[model samples]
Target: MSGFNTSGVLSVAPARMLVPILLILMWYLGRLHSQYEPIVTSKVSSRLEEARKMIPSVKLDWPIPLAKDPRAAFNSSKLALLIEARPLPHLPPLILHMMAVIPPDWRFLFIGSNESIIGVSRAYSIKHQQVIGKLDLVELPPPWSIASKEDVFRLLTDSRFYDEFLTDVEWILKYEHDSILCANSETSVDDGLGWDWTGAARMGDGHFSGYGGLSLRRVSVIKRVLSFQARFNDSEPEDEWFGKRLWVLPGAKVASRFDDAIAVEDVYMERPMGYHIREGGGSLDKSVWGDAARRKEIFEYCPELSMIMDMKLERQRCPDDDGNGDREMADVQVTTAVLGEGDDAKALPNDAESAVLPPQPPPLPQPWKVSVTTFGSPLRTGID
Candidate 1:
């Protein structure tokens, strides 16, 4: 001891340095692994669980009448189907046929303008099935007649409306169960050709066109997107607004099963779908089958649609849009703008391959001086 073992001290010094270095390397590796981990992580799962817990204990399998009469046997187990529409009467018979094909368990929740068209849709919905309950219609306020753009912004951004929208969202989320499924009247159906609707980019020099249809799972995702929209309240175009918001949410997936080759054209940049439909003065009737001739034309020109349909049916899986990856807002904006708009207003290609059309200007409001009947509430009547 008195000799002060310097050799031992020197040996111990290297061990002390090596221990800290090894600890640092281990810490760095742990961080790296976490950074590159898959998005469906424990954190995301926990968030979903928390969100679910926050919702009320509402029963999804509410009993509903099966046949046309409510007095008839309430045999169905499913509760509701949410369909977004504008002028509902114009909905195609094909859409009605598809709805009829659904198992007799679900009821329809039609969101659209409170017009006679809704009444027609309601009649159609209950024609084959029972009218368990009157359709719940959530009317969107018109954006055009506001005093100023700031007023429009205020309406969208107001926390009160945001809270209301959130309540509507939570109500829908509570109903999200295996028994409930959503279907839209409008989708890009393949015409039994060989055109791949799920392609990522367009092929020609003209405007790029793509499909905008989604699966049942996407309905819940859309609710989450609306919640985010309420939270952020950015005033972009509707579909673009919806797409951008979806891109930013954690683990949100998009349905991109449209022909990719035609959608990459530069002309599609300025226009986008939902923009024109919402802005352009047209009824849902005109929107649905308005371009039937065009669809036939495309099938004649590109007979590959029939082949594509067969492939799509065989695959028969929901599109892993956005590549099942965490998509960025920029990606959403870029993709939506490119895919939504076509070459020109009417020039926008319409076929059995693509459901989305380019943005159009909003309709001009009816003159305020005109005499009008005030049904229910003035605020609600004017907005529609």
Candidate 2:
């Protein structure tokens, strides 16, 4: 106290007052906390506010499981392939129908040009098939061409093609736009899985007659053939080129004659699994489709052929024509009359032309009628 002034005098009594003030502040804060606890913990009544509170703090995207992928359920080794460059009108429906009728285990592949790929992929059903993995539409890149028949032939004959694009493929069911499988066929395609190569018969009695329009082929056997043999460009068709060697290839089970035919092309059998109408029936085998009864049977058996083949209604036939391939020759009597005198009168053999009775005009000449005898015969036998 002697060293300090009045400002520095001892203040222990003031310090003693701080404890009560601190206690009062702590008690007031405790009251404030207790009073607002219910409001902070109360359940929200507004739906939007509740939803906001329930939402995840961090955003995330997850995939939903809907339809099953078809590839998981089917055997991808068995491939049904259709290679086309032109976008035909019937492609979408035809492809869908084929998928429906073929074994469910089989997967389909459509290899086409850009235009053709776009043409078919536009269909809702086709898109659905692609989504389900039941089908795939592909357009090959450069150094490969399918714009012509010869180009396709070259493609099938190359071994690199199989290695590059057809990995793990064991079998190939090749079909064209003009070809169709009979939904009513008694035999399913699975029955012929044993054969290395089988298709439409070219000739009734040929040693090797497996036409390629609609065919089932074993990839192992094809690869075996391609390993040692190479196809000449633009020479023989791919089917025939392979067929000739496949027939001779030891252990190869190639279809021969009409007995083993898988489809109907030039030769007719009781019931074929399918039909390969060349040019969509424009070029038909007479022995197979010429007879009226035979055509009726074919149409009755596979009415789906009408989907791709060009045909006329039965009522559209000529009036005097018969159901048979031949048309009946009808006798047409044409009459003509002439007018004037001398040479003009001679021109008209009718007696009315020579008569100068009242000054009446002569009748017009009638056009000559053509009598068609027999219709041209249909193609009997050839390679597809």
Number of the top-ranking candidate, with lDDT as the measure: 2
In candidate 1, how many Å is residue 38 off? 85
Clashing pairs in model 2, backbone N/Cα/C closer than 3 A? none
Model 2: weakest 10-residue lDDT segment is: 350-359
- How do the residues 1-384 of candidate 2 rate in per-residue lDDT, one tens digit apiece? 124458986545666678889999999999998998776666444656889989889967887665565576668689999999998989999899899789998999999999999999999999999988889998988899999999999999898999999897899999999999999998988998999999988763487757858999999999999999998887988988888899889999988777888888887888789999888878777888778987898889999999889888886666555686566654444346566666464243333323222224558887766554444775344332
Q: Write the per-residue lDDT of candidate 1 for residues 1-384, one digit (tens) a residue.
A: 133365655234566678889999999999988886766487788999999999899768878646565523422222233333334333333234334534343333433445633554455554543344423345556642223333444443344543554333211211101111113212222211132111122223112132222112233454555554563344553333444455456774343423322121122221111111211122222322235454354335433223212222324333332322222232121122233355543333323334323335669987665445656766332322
- In candidate 1, stretches whose alpha carbon ends up further than 4 angstroms from where it belongs are 1-88, 91-95, 101-106, 121-234, 256-294, 297-384
Q: TM-score per candidate, in order?
A: 0.30, 0.71
Best by TM-score: 2
RMSD of each: 33.9, 14.9
